[model samples]
Target: MTVSTDPGEAATAAPPVNGNAPGRGHRGPVWLALTLALGLLLGIGVGLVIPQFLKPGDTSPEAGFLRDMSTHHAQAVEMSMIAHSASTTPEIISLSSDIALTQHAQIGYMQAWLRDWNLSPTSSQEPMAWMPDAEGSIVNGLMPGMATPEQMTALRAMTGKPLDVEFLTLMRQHHLGGIHMAQEILKLSDDKNVTWLAGTMVTAQQGEINLIDMLLKKLQTA
Candidate 1:
C-alpha cells in the first residue's frame, strides 16, 4: 500500500463523512436571500426548497457546516476533474463531469453563505468539531470525503484502463464517505436549504454509487 501524507489525515476530522458546509447561519431577510440563493446554487435540478429557516451566528453549526461541506465538495470536484480526463469509459467520464459541475456550483453556494454571514471562510477550531466521532483514518481534520495523498499520486500515474478502475474505486469510497456525512447532517440539521441539500446529496451519491458499482463489475469482467 502506498503512504498517505495528508495533514488532515492524522488530525482525524475528515470533511464530514457526507460533505461539510462552510459557515454558520444568519437572521432576518438574510434567510430569504440565502434560501433563494441556495436554490439557485443547487440549480433547477436539485434546488428543491424547504419551508423552514436557519438561525444566525458567527459560529452557528449551520454556517460551519456549510463552509466545511463546501470545502469538502471542492476536493470532490478536483478529484472528479482528474477522473474526467483519465477514465477509459465514457460513462465514467460523464459521471465524473457531472459530479464536478454540481459540486463546484454548490461550493459557490456555501461560499456565498459565508459572505452573507460576514464570517471567514475557515474555522479556528479543529476540523470535524461539528462531528465528534469523526476521528478515524479516513476521517481527517477537515475533508471527510477526501482521498489520501498516495491515492492521488497513484491516480496521477495511471493513464488508461487501470486509471478507470482505480478512479472508480476511489471515487466510490469518496462518495460513500460523503454519503455517510450527508446522512448525519440530514438527521441533525433543520435549516431548510441545508437539510434539503444534504438529503439530496444522499440520494444523488447513492445512485452514483450504484452506477459506479455496476461499472466496476463490468470492468472487472472485461
Candidate 2:
C-alpha cells in the first residue's frame, strides 16, 4: 500500500506547526458553534427533504440502520477532523473538511431519527444485527472499516506527510466498509429517506475514495 513518491520531493515543505499563537482562544468556541449549527441544519434538512418516508418503529431495520450508521459516520468525522488539523497537504485538508462536514450532518440526521422514534441511541441487540449477512464483515470484533484503538492513536500522534498518507489509507478502507453497510441497508429497508441517505453515502464515499487514491498517487510521486 506504499505510494511511490520520493521523500525528497517534499523539500520545500513547511515544518508542521506545534503550538497555537496568541489570541486564538475564542476560535475554538466559534468553530464548535459553527460545526454544531451545520449539523443541526443538515439533520433537519434530511427530515424535511423527505417527510413522506415511512417512520420505522423502534426495533425495525430502519432504526437499526440509523443507529449503526450514526456510529460509523461518527468515526469518519473524527478521522477527518484529525486530518484537517494535522495534515499539511492542501488536498488532504480540503478532502478532510468535506468529509467532516458531510458526515457530521448525517450524524445529526440519524440522531434526530432516533429522537423522533422515541428510541434509545443504542439497540438491545448487537450492532449490525439488522444485516445478518454483514456479521462476517466485522474486523477486530468491530464493524467493517472501523480503525482500531491503535490506528486511531497513531493517526492522532502523526503529522505532515505521514499523517496525510495514513489518513488517506484509513479513510479509504473506512469508506469501503461504509459503502458495504449502506448498500446492505438499501437492500434491507425501503424507507425513502433511509434509502436516499444510504445511496448518497455510497455515491459520496466512493467519490471520496477516488479522490484519496489520486492524492495517494500524487504523494507517492512527490
Candidate 3:
C-alpha cells in the first residue's frame, strides 16, 4: 500500500550543542499542539482514502480487522506521542518515537485497506465478534488494548521518568492485549491479506515487547 506520513511529524534530531546557547525549555504546549495537529491531519488523510478500499461486500473480515485495528493503533500512537515529549529516559523516548512512526504508517495502511474493501471505517456489530475467543478481553464492552478515557487522560498528564515508566507499563499491557487479538485474526480470518496483517502484528509487537521489557529494566536500574 502507498502509505505516506504527514511531513510535519518527521523528526529533527539535535546534534550535540556547542554548550553556548542555553537549552530551550521544553514547552509542553508547543509539543502537544504540534502532536495534535499532526494526528488530526493524518487522520483526515486516512479518512479520505478509506472509502476507496471498500467493495460491495457488507462486512468482510478485512474490513472488520482494518476498522478495529485502526482504532487500536490510534491509542498506541497517541500514548507513544505523549511519551515522546514527556518521557525522561532516552531509551523510552526512542522507543516511543519508533512506535509513533510505526503505528502511524500502519494506520495509514489499514485505512487504505478499508477503502479497498469497500467498507466504512466505522462498524456496527459488537467489537471482536469476528473472533468469539476475543470476548474474554473486553473492557467496558470495547475490544482489548483500548485505553480507558481516564487512562488516556492520565497518560497525557505525566512527565519525566514517571511518564516513561508508566508509558512502558501501560503500553506493554496494550501490546499483550493486541497480541491476543492478532492471534485470533490469524486463526479466524480467511482473507489472506488480513491473516498476513495479523501475523505481521504478532511478529512486530512481540519484538517490541521484548524491547520494552529491556527498557523497563534499564529504567529501573537508572
The prediction achieving the highest TM-score against the true structure is 2
Clashes of each: 28, 3, 12
lDDT (Cα, tens digit) per residue for candidate 2, span 1-222: 564466655533433345543444548889989999999999999987665455687778889889988988899999999999988788999999999999999888889878886788898878788886766877677788999989999999999889999999999999999999999889888778889999999999999998999999999999
User: What TM-score would you give candidate 3 relative to the actual structure?
Assistant: 0.71
The weakest ten consecutive residues by lDDT in model 2 span: 9-18
Evaluated against the true structure, the overall lDDT of model 3 is: 0.79
- Better structure of 2 and 3 per lDDT: 2
Model 3, which residues run further than 4 Å from truth? 1-56
Which 10 residues in a row give candidate 3 its minimum summed lDDT? 8-17
The lDDT of model 1 is 0.76
State the lDDT of candidate 1 residue by residue for 65-125, as single tens digits.
Answer: 7766777787788788898987667998999999999888878877886776667888885
lDDT tens digits by residue: candidate 3, 1-222: 564475543322333345332454457569889999999999999898774553425465556667788888889999999998887677888989998898888888888777766567888866776666666877796668677888889889988777888899889988988888788777766666677778888998999999989888987998
Alpha carbon deviation, residue 43, candidate 1 (Å): 34
Superior candidate under lDDT, 1 versus 2 = 2
How does each model score on TM-score?
0.71, 0.74, 0.71
